[model samples]
Target: MANSIFIPLHAVPSGLNEIIDLIAFGFSDVGRSVPNVYSAKSSDADENWKDNFVFVEDVGSGERCWVSFFETTPDVTGNKEWTWLAGVTARWSWDFAGVVAYALCSYADSIVYNDSGVLTGQEEYSAKDLKGILSRD
Candidate 1:
């Protein structure tokens, strides 16, 4: 079985198409669905939309995770609020090279690794030594 984890991004940049494509390649099972990603909606009370969340899945192992982006905002009392706006649902297995490659190539800084394992697309990072740089941080 593949391990899963959540990767939270401060915000999803405009250049997300390429990353999505890469994630599709990395995971065998890729599906596009309308997800209730926004947290400000009234329907979020019971978490009914939780299942509606879209994600990528690893067909081989059924390991999956979701990516959510929320804009920071101030509430009525000036308190911080993580207003979820949009996100992607992804499911994957041990072979996450393609996912890693897509993520690194698209937005290396926004990446948040939840699990430690052999990542796909090691070749692309070889020259740039992304792994080395990432590890240092």
Candidate 2:
């Protein structure tokens, strides 16, 4: 089973390219020092789904974690939004990958959406809660 969480960006800034760059920079700033942290972007048309997303993976020990982003439906006001997903493999702790996801969302001034699609305010996240969000078991 994997543990996962979804973060949604409320009002993305005007420039799309800038936001992508910001997310990449933010992830690097927080995750660069973590061992075996790697990042990639989807190249397949179907996989990308016309959204800007970066995927992060930890290629270290027995347990690994991953993070990525995807575009979601527009808000009521019709502003574009994105959902960032972070997850850890079974028995793995929320590590640098999770931190990078959080940092990317923070830099984008994003919000969180529960499984029910309700908006969650910008509140601090606990490891347990985040794991719960990512859990598939």
Candidate 3:
């Protein structure tokens, strides 16, 4: 199973592409759909044109902690919003996922979200909040 986080972006410095540099982490494009997601239309919703899917990894030593950049088709979903569905597999990868989200929050003007692990609402984590979680030893 994988733990997931939702990064609802407001305005990235150079659109979605900026995220590649902002995170400063190692990742590779395992695969991606054709036709480019940015040019997708709302009327094309029925086709469900989901976008890029990348795999995150450690900078060196090739430590693999699979992270998927699940970008859903916004127009099809009926909301003009974008989110980084950073899904982390395995327990060890959870922290890596947090680090990725933390870096994103620091550079971007938005918050990230995930399960609170409680019975109630989701946890809307800030860069500071994720730092606290990641710093725990």
Give the best candidate by lDDT: 3
- State model 1's lDDT: 0.36
Q: After superposition, how far is residue 10 of candidate 2 from its true place, in Å?
A: 5.5
TM-score of each: 0.33, 0.43, 0.51
The TM-score of predicted model 2 comes to 0.43
Off by over 4 Å in 3: 11-17, 25-50, 59-91, 116-122, 135-137
Cα lDDT listed for each candidate: 0.36, 0.43, 0.46
Model 2 over residues 1-137: C-alpha lDDT tens digits?
45455555543333434444654564455434333433343333234423443444444444344544444565521345443332222235555445544554566465333332211333445334433443333
Q: All predictions: root-mean-square deviation over Cα?
A: 10.5, 8.4, 9.7
Task: Quote the positional error of residue 122 for candidate 2 in Å.
Answer: 11
lDDT-better candidate, 2 vs 3: 3
2 or 3, which is superior by TM-score?
3
Candidate 3 structure quality by residue, lDDT tens digits, 1-120: 545665554333333344445555312111111111122223422322234343445554343343344455555223365543444333445655556666656665556666634112
Which structure is stronger by lDDT: 1 or 3? 3
Which tens-of-lDDT digit does each residue in 50-113 have in candidate 1?
Answer: 3343344445545555554445443511223322233333445323333443343334233333
